[model samples]
Target: MGIVLNQSLKNTIITYLGFGIGAINTLYLYPVLLGATFYGLTNYITSCANVIMPLFAIGMQNSLVKFYSQYKTIDEKSRFLSFTVLFPLVLIIPMLLISLYFYDEILYFLSKKNEIVKYYVWLIPFIGLCMAYFEIFYAWARVHMHSVFGNFVKEVGLRLFSLLLLIAVNFDWLTVEGFVYATAGLYFLAFLVTMFYAFGIQKPTFQFAMPSNSKEILTYTFYIILSGSVANLLLDGDKIMLNQYMIIDNIAFYSIATFIALVISVPSRAMHQIVYPITAKLMHENKFEELNVLYKKTSINLQVVGGYVMLGIFVNINQLYAMIPKEYSGGLLVVFMIGISKYFDLILGNNNAIIFNTKYYRAVLFLGVLLVAVAIGLNMLFIPLYGIMGCAFATLLSITLYSVAKLLFVVKRLHLYPFTAQTLYSIIITFILFILFYFWEFPFTPVLSIFLKALLITLIYVYINYKFVISTEINEAIDFVLNKIRK
Candidate 1:
């Protein structure tokens, strides 16, 4: 448990480091150097490839984690890993080929004008394959409780490599076409790095022995594909939708704001990766009480961390955008909506993981697909009328519905609820903090005002939490930091 906590702390730090680099690249460098449209195209293309990669993955990543413990022998695990690799490739390869065949048609349908879509067309398969295998390798590492390397590679390594590409563009060393290819190429490189690391650490062998359990594995994989696809679309569908309905520049503006908003999810992402297998192990042992405790702790802690992050970004948004050009500032609303949506998911803790790892996993995903369909329908109706704000609103509603449904399902099936008097208390405390700060606008430059506002909000919020103990979990976290500093 201590090791898990330490590794999580390390991963969280690295994720923020990566976020810092991304903040510079997406919000400042890309928009300043490439303009909003090209930046949007870059983001949309990368997200499209990402969203589609899971479709090819066939849920093998989650399946790998869920099924690994069932195999006791070393050889059995090896065969299982090999089969995991084979399963996703079998589907991913064909899908890539098909997409390639219809590349031109896809471009025409996705864009309003005959833009330089071909420059990035080849990246579809390359990125899709890269992303597919990255998840596979990460899953392989995760089952061994060695997730920090994968998290670093996935979260930080990609951003570092992308930062290099941005530097090239900023320095006039690469054209937009070159930048696009570089973006795709970086994922492939990161995948390779993680693969080598997995081999070094797990040294998983390349062998197959048709376990009698293979049938169960295959069935799980099949359902997981649908599940993975739906999850992918729910998260990544907005960029795809934006690409289809608007210009690349709009996507760029939206992407910049989305990047900032995504910072709010760092805590959730770090916690989830470590918590998933832990939760699965608890379920496997029928330790329902432990699972319940974990659910509540995770929800409260995640909200504590994510709330601070969202507060920082919200309080500093105007100054943050002032750092960028005026043209890209329209994404401010997108940032707020998406940030709230993601933080809301954080508030639900590991509800999705609980559902996916349980017996009712398939039904959970089926419901996810229905919600995703509604999300797409709403985006279609909204993106055209309200542009990025519409997409943001649609996403917020869809994810809220999805989170509520999952929460209800878990409460019914497991008889667990991740809320308490503290939850309501935190809400009230947060609201009062917002109200106190809302009326305290100072007469200063936008940049100065944002800096002062963020400082005051941080101080006031912290003081309130300390005074009221809105979250004992958070108070303890603060104590830990203070103790470390004293040392």
Candidate 2:
């Protein structure tokens, strides 16, 4: 618990710092600097790369984490490590060739509405390849229980690089086209750094010989590809699909709205880094009781923290948007929809860790494939009808349904539920804060108003929760912070 809390806290801070830099790039710099069309084009390229990354990665990042601990001998571990590093290339090299063969046709389809995308179509594979190797090596570091450096690279490094690029563009130091190329270069650079760390953690002996359980590992890798792809599709698919049905510039507005909501998941993402390998070890030891406790605590702790982010975003969203250009203003509904989905994601806690580490992962994988189809289908139907709002609607429905299905499966198969009585309390607190602050506003500048409202909400909300002892975990965190202050 101590290690998990310490690492999660550090990770949460790093993630939020990254997100703050990203917010500036998205809301302030992109809209004001690049305007609508270029902003949308930039996001579309990255989103497409993310969607393609899992397939190129061949699920070896996940498979590495699951299988690395199975081998006992250093030689055997080296061989297994060698397998994870090399297996993905078998898929990546061929995919690159196929991409080259169909490059023109692919460009035509992707650039149907926004021909600007054609100029950068080649970046999709380039960025995807970099993202693929970064994760593979990041997972390598995770299994070594050295996740902070990886987290810093993942959460902060990219955004920091992006900030410098955006600044360059803003100051007339570079053109937008140059910014695009720099973005691709940044991803490749990050990949090299992560690969270096991975090797340093455990210098691979390059023993590429096959283990006896080669079949088992390859099988898991195959399923995890779909599993990995499903998550990316749900997160980035809406933006990609928007390019087909509507003006590509609309994604800029949608991106800003979703960014405000996506911040809610930062805690969950941070905690999951360390939790994943720990979950794997726990499951391997058959310690269902410990796993169950972890599941509930994570759910409640995430809910408590994520709930605050949701409140802060929703209550002050109007003011936040007011500061942005009017063209990006139709996203209140988008934020609400995506924000709620993010909260649901947080409450599920380490459910992903459990499912991915367990044998039943394939079942979840099949379910994910089905849901990806449903998400794409829904986007096709809804985006045409409601425009960007419709896109949000489709995402909300798909994510909600996906989360419910996951919760039910975990309950039925693992006999573990993340919900406790305090779960209801957390929701009630979030709702109460929303009700209290949603309509209240100070007649001041947007920044000052947001600060006062947030401070008031934090004070009243934390005081009430502490008084009631809503969660032992939250109470303990409060105590630890207070103790530190006194010392």
Candidate 3:
């Protein structure tokens, strides 16, 4: 818990900083500078890339985390690492070749509804490849218990780079088309930097031979690839589907609302970097008792912290929409639905890591694939009927159903639960705060009102959690920060 809390706090700060920059870019600059058409195209390109990234990497990133701690000998570890790096090429090379061979047909298929996407179709595989390797290297760093630097590069570095690119667009130094191209190059740069950082941590010995556990490794990688695809599809698939059924501009509107909603998951994202590998280690050593303890602690801690974020976002959502363009303001319902879905996922804590690392992961992967099919079906049914709001509803229902299934599976199979009495108390606190803050707004500008409202909410929320000691770990963390401040 000590290491988990320490690194997660730092990662949370970094992630929020990135999200802040992303908010500026998504909410302001993209809409104002590029306008809706190109802004939506930009998001569309990236969303497509994200959806295909798992195929390119072939699950090496997750495989590295799950298997790295099992090897005792450095040579054995080196061989395993070598396999992770080289194995993906088998799939990546063929996919690229296939894309090249059917490039024209692929373009026609993707751009049938929206012609703007035709020219940028190539960037999907290119950026997906870059994303794949970046995660592989990022996982390399995480397995060694050095996630902060990678998190910084991933969270802060990429968004800051995008900020500069947007600034370039503003100065008329780069056209919007150029901005899109440069974004692909930016991902490549991130991949390069992380690859170097990972190598510095453990210089690759380049053992070309496969490890002795090749059968088991290959099997796990196969399931993980499907699992990763299912996860990403849940996150970004709606945007891709939007491109299919709606005009490109509506995606920009959807992107803005989803970005605001995504803030609630920051704590979970930060904690997962460190916690995934630790969960893998615990599972490997059969530390069910320790694993159970970790499960409960992370659940309560993330619920409390993530609940604060959801409160802030949900209570002040109207003010947030007011700050964005009027056209994007219709997504208030989108924000609420997606925000609730993310908060539900947050409270599940390290449920993903627990499921992915265990032998029963294959069962969960089957369930994930079925749920993704359900999500796609829902999107197809809803998007044309209700536009962005309909897409949000589909996302909300699919994610909620998927989350519930995962929670139940973990409980039924492992007999471990992520909730305690503190969980109920945290939920009560969150509900109370949301009700009190949701109806009122300070009589000032959106910016001032948001600041004041957020400040008031933070003070009261922190006080009650501290007083009640909803989580001993969180209480200790507050004390640690306060003591540091006093010194």
TM-score of each: 0.95, 0.98, 0.99
Between which residue pairs do clashes occur in model 2?
A: none
Can you write out model 2's per-residue Cα lDDT over 1-487, one digit (the tens) per residue? 3888888988999999999999889889988778899889889999999999999899988887888888898888888888878888888999989989999899899998888999999998999999999999999999998888889998899999989988898899989888888989999999999999999998878865887699998888888888889999999999999999988899988999998999999999999998888898899889999999999989998988899888889999998988889989998899999999999989999999899888898888889889989999999999999999999999999889888898899999989989989899889988987988898889999989988998988898899888888778779889988999999
Which window of ten consecutive residues has the lowest lDDT sum in model 1? 110-119
Q: Quick one: best lDDT, which candidate?
A: 3
**TM-score winner between candidates 2 and 3:** 3
lDDT tens digits by residue: candidate 1, 232-263:
78788888888777777778888888888889
Error of 3 at 192 (Å): 0.1
Model 3 regions lying over 4 Å from their true place: none
The lDDT per prediction is 0.80, 0.90, 0.93
Write one digit per residue (lDDT tens) for candidate 3, span 196-280. Answer: 9999999999978989999999999999999989999999999999988888999889999999999999999999999999999
**lDDT score, residue 386, model 1?**
98
Q: Distance (Å) between predicted and true CA of 218, model 2?
A: 0.9
Query: For model 3, where is the 10-residue window of minimal lDDT?
Result: 1-10
lDDT of 2 at 120: 92
